[model samples]
Target chain A: MKKTVYRIYTSIIFLFLYAPIGTLMVLSFNSSKTRAKWGGFTLKWYSELFQNDAIMKALWNTLAIAFLSAVFASIIGTIACIAMTGMKKKWRSVLLGITNIPMLNADIVTGISLMLLFLTFGFKFGFLTILLSHITFNIPFVILSVMPRMQGLNPSTYEAALDLGAGPVQAFFKVVFPDILPGVLTGFLMAFTMSLDDFIITHFTKGAGVDTLSTKIYTEVKKGIKPEMYALSTLIFIAVILLLLLANSRSKIKSVKTAERGKS
Target chain B: MNKKMLSLPYLFWSIAFILIPLGMIFFYGFTDKTGAFTLENILAISQAEHMKALWLSILLSLISTIICLALAYPLGLILTSMEVNQNGFIIVLFILPMWMNFLLRTLAWQTLLEKTGVINGILSFLHLPSLNIINTPYAIVLGMVYNFLPFMVLPIYNSLAKIDRNVINAAKDLGAGNLYILKRIILPLSFPGIVSGITMVFVPALTTFVISTLLGGSKILLIGNVIEQEFTQASNWYLGSGLSIVLMVFIIINMVLSAIFDKDGEGGLL
Candidate 1:
């Protein structure tokens, strides 16, 4: 009896969670533009989604910003992690606390503050400003992701490489880099995801003419329920589902292998 | 020795991008358009409209955070108690929605809750009275809860999953009943996750302009909406920055609370 209640409750929560995504998927195929009526089942919106120049531009912008910012953040954050190994605990903690400021503060404040920075500096508000803001907000995620791996590093291995006459850069790439690579990759992915989903900061920093998918959708909603927007979201939803499933299965397989190794 | 110089680039970046921008906010917050220092901008929060918006933002976000906690706690309990493999599947399901652009998801709710939208359509088919709450504060709360629920869930689950089963078993082996074990054993141990989760939900919900704009019609204003307008529409940078300072106070308080509770940083997103 108790189990049944839990099951029903879980289902209800899942229903609430998926209902919006399901609506978007269903609406993507509806021939009618309005949600009030279904004109008929149609695939026109998906096709239209590709051909739409404005949205295509926004998509390109989104990808570029996400990729560039993630790459930049990873570089800076990884370097910061490396340098921290040689620093005192006090300064490292202070720097880390500074890093958390962006993550903890409200997005609107970060957004507006960056905007304010651009205005005060007389910097042109365009793609670069948005890119800068993304990198700023994205660094903390990369740092947090990489810090643990950095902390756990076997410094002796790097010293061993150094003692064997491998140069500093060469030693790091040979020993330390390989060890911390996983964390850096994770940080890069996290940064990428955050930049891609970002709307508020982008909305503020993106001045006239530039638009990401989020900003475009915001403007699109004010005009009407464009079925094309739903189509875009559906594609993204499906892509995320597939990628996560792939990642999940791979991890599961790895775990199974580890368990078997333990038994053997 | 020179390896320490590797962080110089980041140090410069932080000073330029992070530190300077923050200083600019203070500069703007305390100055007028003429750039002279003044108390008027910071004091503007006491105006009836701004105060109303601030209170409304606080009230609605509070409601949303509480609802998210109420919903997520049981779900976390269920997830943590499940077989380890099964935990991943449900978590993936929960996380999938977060990948979809949130603005779009919140907009989807606008369709689902509209007068002629899906829910109303279903109600009419069942011979039930149609419900309408779109473009209201209720709709905004719904948006907050829908968008931020995952933030509440993930941290709580992580922390709960970290609890040693032996501790619970020991409690059970003692004279404690199930409810007592939950209250005494699980709750205290899971406080970090709960605190982090609350901070995660509350900060975004409190500072959200997008959710409110998408759901609550223009007539409804949250502090976020007011600050956004002050910058974007009114072009009053001083007023916008000043109001943001007020928002920052609340955010810092939330952060300090989480910092206190999650001292070991067990459940912290950082």
Candidate 2:
């Protein structure tokens, strides 16, 4: 009885969570422009989503910004983590505290602050500003992810590489880099997702004619959201699901192999 | 030793982007258009419109945070009690909805709750009372709870999962009943998670303009909406920055509380 109750409760929560998403997926195939009644199912929206140039552009911008910001943030964040590992304890904590500012502060404040900075400097609120703002926010996420792995690095192996006559750069890369690769990958993925999901920050930082899918959706809110957007969102959702599944399976296989190796 | 120099780029970046930008908010917030330092902008929060918006934002966010806590704590408990393999998959399932666009998700609720919406359609078909809460504070609260529930759940679940089973077993052996154990051990142990979850939910819900704008309609104003309008529509950066500073005070209090409770940073998403 207890187990059944737990199962029922879980099912209700899951339904509540997915109801919106399921509605969106259903609406993508909706033939009627209006959401009130379901018209007969049609695939026209999917085709129309592809044909819509402005939306396609926004989609492209979203992907490009997510990718670029993640890559840049990963580089800077990993380097920061390495530097932090060598720092005095007080200074390291201080830097980490600063890093948390973007993470802990409300998005509106961060967005507004960056907007003030851009305007103060007489900079245009365009792709560059948006990218810069994203990179700033993304860096902390990357650092948070990578810093733990940095702390776990065994110094002996690195010193052993040095004793073996490897150059400092070579020794660090071959010994330390591989050890922290997983953390770095995790950080990069986190940053990418954050950039892709950002709407408020992008809304403030983005200029006229520069629309991420998020900003595009926001603008369309006052006007009715287009059916093509529903189709686009459904596709994006499916893609994320597939990617997560692939990541999950790969991790499962790796864990299984590690278990087997441990038994041996 | 030379590796310490590697932090230069990040140090420069943070100073230029993070610290300097924040400083700009203070600067703008404290100054007038001619750059004269004055407290008028900051004092503007006491004005009728601004104070009402602030109070409403606080009241609604508090309600949403409480609702999220109530809903998520049980779910977290259930999740932690499950098998390890099942736990990971279930947590992932909960987080999956977050991967979708939040705007689109909120927009979905707008469709469902609108008078001519699906929920009402279903209600009328069943001869049940239609939901008239759309475009009200109740709808906004629903949207907040829906959007931020995962943030509350994840942290609580993480902290709950970390509790040692042996400790619970020891408590059971010590003649503690289920209610006593829950109240004494489980609740106290999960305090950090609860604090972190509250901060996470409360901060966003308080600062959210989009959720309120979509669900609350234009008639109801939030502090976030006021600030957003100042920056975007009104083009009054000084007033916007001032209101943001007021909002930041609440956010800072939340951060300080989370920092005090979650010292180990165990409540983080990772």
Candidate 3:
């Protein structure tokens, strides 16, 4: 009886959590001008969204920024993870704590400070500035994601590789690299998602005439919630769900393979 | 050892990209408009009203964090107990909103909370009077909770998933009640997750401006809003930097205090 009650309560909580999101998805196709009224469904908003040049440009900019930031963050973060793993544990902890500051700090503050820094540096607000700032936050995320997997590796694997006549680079690439690939990929995807979703940092750093989807969404909602924004959101949500399913299945496959290896 | 080769790139990037920019932000906090760095800007930020706003941000974040933890603890319990397939589905459902645009999610709440919005529409349909929910602190809390609930849930779930089932079974065999086991065994063991969740939710909630701006209206002010006003509105980058520094200090203090309270420090050890 108690277990059933618990299950029912969990469902209710989940409903509360998902209701607004599910509602937004449903209402994206609502033919009514007002969000409240449930008029007949129509596919007009999505088609309208595609035709808007401004939205298209913004979406492109968002993708570009997300890609650039994720790639840069992945490189820096992988290097940092490699370096940190060799340090004394205490120093490693301190380094990690420092890296995590950007993640924990208020986005508004970070955004403003970065803006101020750009002004002080006499740099223009555009692709480079936004990319640099995004990378700052992204690197920490990547590091956090990658560090665990790095630590989880068997220490003697590298030793065995070296003893087998492999040079340092060869040993790292041949042995260590393959083990932490999942962590690296996870970090890359996380950074990509973060860059895609960020508004606060991008808002402050973006130059004139450069509108990312987040900034565009901010402006549109500030004016009024439009169906086009909802349509865009629905599409973005679907894309994320698809990516998540792919990542989940891929990891499961890897897990099963690992289990089989353990059995052998 | 590849330490020397690796250290070069790590040090170069950290100094050039991370340390320099951070130093510039801190340096600018001390500089006035005359191109000279001064302490005047720091003093200006210490005014009474700014202090109140700082306190308010902390208090509001604390309240929201508490409420989120309340919701998350039970939710985490249920999630951790589920089969892996079901757990994965629940996680997707939970984390999906986090992937959606933050501004849009907050806007969704605004649409739902307004007089003609979904909540009020439901209320009126149920023969109840519509109540004002937007442009208030409550709205800000709602927005924060909505935006960050997953951050709280995920960490707790991660910790609970790692628990040894034999510990619970042993407690059960020893005649411990379910409530006692949860309190003394599960909750104690999950302290790190609780800590991470608190930091994840509380830190962001403390500094959220977009949610407050969209939902809390002009009446509601957080430190984030004040920081924005200083730089963009007031054109006082110095003062804004000071506020940012103060906010950073407060965050450090919060982390330390949480660590201390964690006793084992697992909550804050990270």
Candidate 4:
């Protein structure tokens, strides 16, 4: 009886969670533009999604920004983490505190502040400004993810590489890089997702004619949303599901291997 | 190698992008359009319309945060009690919606709650009462809770899953009942997660303009809407910056509380 109740409760919550998503997916295929009644199912929206140039441009911008920001944030964040590992405790904490500012502050404040900064400096609010703002926010996520691995790093192995006559860069690549690879990968993925999901910050920072998928969606809100957007979101959702499943299975295999090694 | 030199780029970036930008907000908040010092912008919060918006934002966000907590705590407990592999699968399911565009997700609710929407259509078919809460504060609250529930769940679930089973077993062996153990051990142990979850949900809900705009309609005004209008429509950067600084005070208070409670930062996003 208790188990039954628990299952029922969980199912209800899951229903609440997935209902909107399921509704959107269904609407994506509806032939009618209105939500009041379901029209016969059709694949026209999917084809139309591809043919829409503005949406295609927005999609391209979204992916490009997410990718570039993640890459840049990963490099800068990893370097900062390494530097932090060697810093005095007080200074390291101070840096970490500063890093948390973007993460902890409300997105609106961050958005407006950056907007004010760009306007003050007379920097054009275009793709570059959006990219810069994303990189700024993305860096902290990368650092937070990498910092734990940095803390766990074996200094002896790095010192041994140095003693073996390897140059500093060579020693780092040989010893420290492999050890922190998981953290770096995780950071990069996190940053990518964050950039992709961001809307408010992009809305404030983006200029005229520069539309990410998010800003594009916002513009369409006052006007009725196009059916093409629903189709695009459906594709994006399917893609995310596949990617996460792949990542999940790979992690599962890795854990199984670790367990086997432990037994050995 | 001067290891410190490696951080110089990041240091410069933060100063330029983070610190200076924040300083500009303060500068704008306290200055007039001509750049003369004035407190009028800051004092604008006391005006009737602004005050109403601020209070509405606070009230609605508080309710959403509470509702999120009520829903998530049990969900977290359930997730933690599940087998490890099952736990992972379920969490993935919870996080899946977040991967979709947030605006679209909220917009989906807009469709469902409209008078001729899915829910109402179903209800009328069944001869049940239709939900007419769309374009009201209630709809806005629903949107907030829907969007932020995952943020609340993930942290609480992480903290709860980390609790040592042996400690619970020990408590059981003592004279404590299940309720006693939950109240004393589980609740206190999950305080950090609870604090972080509250902070995460509350701040966004309080500052959200999009959710309110889509669900609350133009009829309801939020502080976020006021600030956004000032920046985008009204082009009153000084007034916008001033209102933002006021909003930042609430955010800072929440952050300080979270920092006090979650010292280990264990409740951070995974």
Candidate 5:
């Protein structure tokens, strides 16, 4: 009886969580232009999403920003993690706490704060500003993810590589890089998604003509429903789902490989 | 190459993007149009409309956070009890929704809860009363909970997953009742997750203008809405920055309070 109760309760929670997205996906196929009614089933919106220049432009902008910001964040964050290891504990903690600000502060504040900085510098509020804001928030996620792997490092193997006549860069690449690669990849993927889903910061920092799917959707909602909005969202939702599944399976395979390595 | 040299780029990035931008908030927040320091902008939270908005944001966010906590704890316990330990799958399930463009999902709710929406349509089909809660605080709270529920669940479930089954079994063997075991063992161990979940839910819910905008409609004004308007519509950067500082104070208070509970930041997301 208790088990039945738990099962029923769990299903209910999952239902609550997924019902909206599922409905949106279903609606994407509906022939209805208005959200209030289901006009019938149709695939018109899916094809229309490709032809809609505004959405296609926003999609291109979103992907470019998510990809570029993730790449930069991973590089900067990984280096910072490495450098912090050699620093005095006091300064390291201070920098780490500073890193937490972008993560912990309200996104609206972070958005506004960055906006003020750009205003002061007379920077154009466009793709670059949005990219800058994304990278700022993205770095902390990379740091938090990568720092754990860095802490779990076995130092002697790295030193052994160094003493065996490998250069510092060579030693790191040979020994230290593989262990932390997972964390770095995880951080990179996280940063990418954070950028992909970011509306608040992008909304604040983006200027005329540049729109991510998120900011575009926000404006579209205010103006009234566009049929392509549902199609585009469904596509994004599917893309995210695939990305996460790939990440999960990759990690699982890695863990299995490591477990076999441990046995050997 | 000095190992510290590797951080030079990060240092420059942080100072330029992180520290200076943060300093800019303080500068704009504390100063007026002439670049002179003034408390009036910071004190704008006291205006009747601004105060109402802030008060409502806090109240609605609190309600949603509490609702999320109550809902998540039971679900976390049940999921943990099912022995789905730290597998990447369940987490992916929770996280997938969060990553799905939140604007679309929340706007979907606006449709689902509309007067002639899916729910009302279903209710009429069944000869039941329609849920007329859209465009109200309840709808806003629901939006907050929907958007942030995953944030609460993941942390709580992670912390709960860390509890050893043996300890709980040992407590049970010592004649502790289920309620007693929950109170004495499970509750304290999950404190970090709970605290983390609260702040995770609270801070975002507290400052969300979008959720209120989409779900509550233009009739409702949250502090986030007020600040957003000050920047976008009014173009009052100083006042916008000033009001943001007030939000930051609340966020800091939340972080400090959670820090007291989860000192090692154990309440962090999975």
Candidate 6:
């Protein structure tokens, strides 16, 4: 009886979470201008999404920003993690707390604060400022993802490589890099998703004439309701789902490989 | 020389980008245009009505956080108990609305809750009175809960999934009822997630001007709107900085109070 009730309850909760997105996706394909009624199914919205230059441009811009921010954040976040690992424990914890303030800080506060700094410094809102800010927020996630793996890593491999006449750089490149590559990749993927998904900070930092998909969506929503916006949202939702699947599969493969390694 | 060379880039990044900007925010909070620091301007700006706004923002945030927790606790438990199939689907459902641009989501809610929108249409179709949820405190809460539900759910889900089933089974085998088991066992174990989720929800809800601006339609004035006005319209950096500081302090105080107040039965670390 309990099991039956549990199953029913769980199904309702899942449906509650998913039903809205499913409705949105279905409405995107609906030929009706209004979302209230399902008129007829057509591939017209997807075609409309493709032919829209502004949407295409925004998609490209979003991808470019996500890519640039992810790469930079991974490199910087990984180095920061490595640097933190060598620090005194008490000092390290303090630094960790300090670095994590951005994560905990309210988005409006952070966005406004960064906006103020940009104005004060006379820094133009463009690719570089947005990238830097993205890295700032993305770094915490990468740090969180990579730090645990770094802690679990056995340091003896690097020591063994050094004792075998390998220079520190050579030892790091050949030994340490391969072992931590999965964690670093996971961090990179996380940063990419975060940068792609960012709205509030991007809205504040994006100057005139520069727009990501998020900013574009915001503008569209304000200017007028458009069915193309739903189409674009559906596309983004699908892309995120695909990437998440790829990440999950890759992590599963890594887990199996690690299990095999342990057995051997 | 080698170590310094290696550390130079990081030092420059942290100092120039992070530390100095933070210092500027602090300095600008105090100083005037001539760069002389004074509390006069800040003090003059903090009137009784501004105090009311501060309290209102805090109260609304507290309420919204509670609602999000009430919704999320059951939902999080359900997510954790289910078999993992299409987790990507589940995550996307949870995260896409959050990712889709906050303004757009707020606008969608506005559309959905509009007098002519789906909710009213459905109500009227069912021979019920069309309710006016927009431009109310309830609307503000609803918008906030919709936006921040995922934040609350994710942390609690993470915690619930991490709980050992054997412990739950042991409690059940000892003839503990579901309610007692949840109250004594599950809730205690998930306190960390609850703490994290509450913090996440409260902080954002406190400063969410967009929701209030769009849905509440000037009915509710949050601290965020006031800060926005100070920076953009009023051009009073000193007052804005002072307000920012006050808001931050208020948020921290609320956090501490809630932490103490909420963790009654559970052994939670302050």
Evaluate residue B182 in candidate 3 and report its C-alpha lDDT on the 0 to 100 scale.
87
Model 2 fnat? 0.82
Two-way TM-score contest, 4 vs 6, winner: 4
lDDT of 3 by residue, B62-133 (tens): 989999999999878886776554436766777677777778777777668888888898899999999797
Native-to-model Cα distance after best TM-score fit, residue A70 in candidate 6, in Å? 1.3
Q: Where is the poorest 10-residue window by lDDT in model 4 chain B?
A: B261-270
Q: What value does the lDDT take at residue B101 in candidate 5?
A: 82
Q: Which model is ahead, 3 or 5, in terms of lDDT?
A: 5
When summed lDDT is taken over every stretch of 10 residues in candidate 4 chain A, the lowest stretch is A1-10
Candidate 3 residue spans exceeding 4 A from truth: A34-39, A87-94, A154-167, A246-264, B35-39, B45-49, B83-87, B265-270
How do the residues A9-34 of candidate 2 rate in per-residue lDDT, one tens digit apiece? 98999988998999999999999998
Q: Cα deviation in Å at residue A212, candidate 3?
A: 1.2
Error of 1 at A33 (Å): 1.7
lDDT of 1 by residue, A10-93 (tens): 889989998998988888999988876788999999999899999899999999999999999999999999988888899899
Q: Candidate 6 — which pairs collide?
A: none
Task: Report the TM-score of candidate 6, chain A only.
Answer: 0.89
TM-score of every model versus the real structure: 0.96, 0.96, 0.91, 0.96, 0.95, 0.87
Tell me, what's the RMSD of every candidate?
2.5, 2.5, 3.0, 2.6, 2.8, 3.6
If the candidates were sorted by their DockQ against the true structure, best first, what order would they fall in? 2, 4, 1, 5, 3, 6
State the lDDT at B150 in candidate 5: 91
Q: What is the C-alpha lDDT of each candidate?
A: 0.89, 0.92, 0.82, 0.92, 0.90, 0.76
Best by DockQ: 2
Q: In candidate 6, what are the lDDT values of residues A1-264, reduced to their tens digit?
A: 866777786676555445456656776888988765668998798888889888888888888989988888788777777777776788668667766777877776676677778888899987777777787778777888888888988989888999999998898789988877888998898788788878777866677888887777666654555678778877777876687678789988998899999999
Candidate 3 at residue A47, lDDT?
93
Which residue pairs collide in model 1, if any?
A: none
lDDT of 6 by residue, B1-270 (tens): 332343344445656656666666677788887889877546644687677777778888889999889988987777777756353455666765654545655666665677887678879999999989988888888878877888898888888887899999999999999999888888888887888898889888998777787788775788888887777679787777777766767667767765675565254523
How many pairs of residues collide in model 4?
0
